[model samples]
Target: MSIAEERIDRLHTLAKQAVAAREFDRSREYVRLARRIAERNRCGLPREFKRFSCPRCDVYLRPGVNARVRTQDGHVVVTCDCGELKRYPYQS
Candidate 1:
């Protein structure tokens, strides 16, 4: 893994911890920082970390809490708390 990927992994872990602690704002900050780092390095976030955030609002998503997750029509649809829907296709 590249340095950027490593940083992204660490950030995602921190984000999850903050969200679990009910510190939504702090989680968002971690997400924003991870985004900046990825942008600067021209690398995308790891696939496992991609679905846990709202790109538009920078919210850390917790299914059944602040987000809705559904598998439909061969896609995974993630609806953020802000009502923004993001869809990702099933690889297989």
Candidate 2:
């Protein structure tokens, strides 16, 4: 069967127990399943996840253990080997 159909079937079965007992853990599992199904169907996320951005350059921010920054104007000036800060937009 199709991924969406499979997810819908599982969701239907899980819905009863998930709602009846207010089982958040089980409900979360269902949510994950839904996400997987959406991905499989190329349907995309219901909502995007929030991401941090760079203040000085108005660029996308990516933090790493080895990355260093200089502090200025209450914000860190990020310098990368590529000479440009990578921007990561919200994706769900």
Candidate 3:
């Protein structure tokens, strides 16, 4: 993977660890920083990492805690606690 991709992957892993430890703010910081780095490098974030945050609020989402996920109409719909909704197309 490219340097930017590697950095993003590392950040996502750290974010997951932070969220698991109930450190949501730390997770958010990690996500934000990762996103900034990706943007700076003109690289898109992988789908795995994108699933961890709300596009609008930019906050890390923990399913069953701060977010709800549902698959509908061939899409994955993510609803954040802040009431932001995001939908990603499903392949199957």
Best by TM-score, which number? 1
**Which tens-of-lDDT digit does each residue in 35-78 have in candidate 1?**
99999999998776777889888978998878899999889999
lDDT of 2 by residue, 16-47 (tens): 35635656456446655655676678754322
Pairs in clash, predicted candidate 2: 60-87
Query: Pick by lDDT: which candidate is best?
Result: 1
Alpha-carbon deviation at 59 in model 3, angstroms: 1.8
User: Using Cα atoms with residue i matched to residue i, what is each candidate's TM-score against the true structure?
Assistant: 0.86, 0.35, 0.85
Residue pairs with backbone atoms closer than 3 Å in model 1 (clashes)? none
The local distance difference test score of each candidate is 0.89, 0.45, 0.86
* TM-score (C-alpha) between model 2 and the true structure: 0.35
- Tens-place lDDT per residue, model 3, 1-92, is 89989999999889888878888788889999999999999999988788778777677788887889999989989898889988889797
Question: Over 4 Å off in model 3, which ranges?
Answer: none
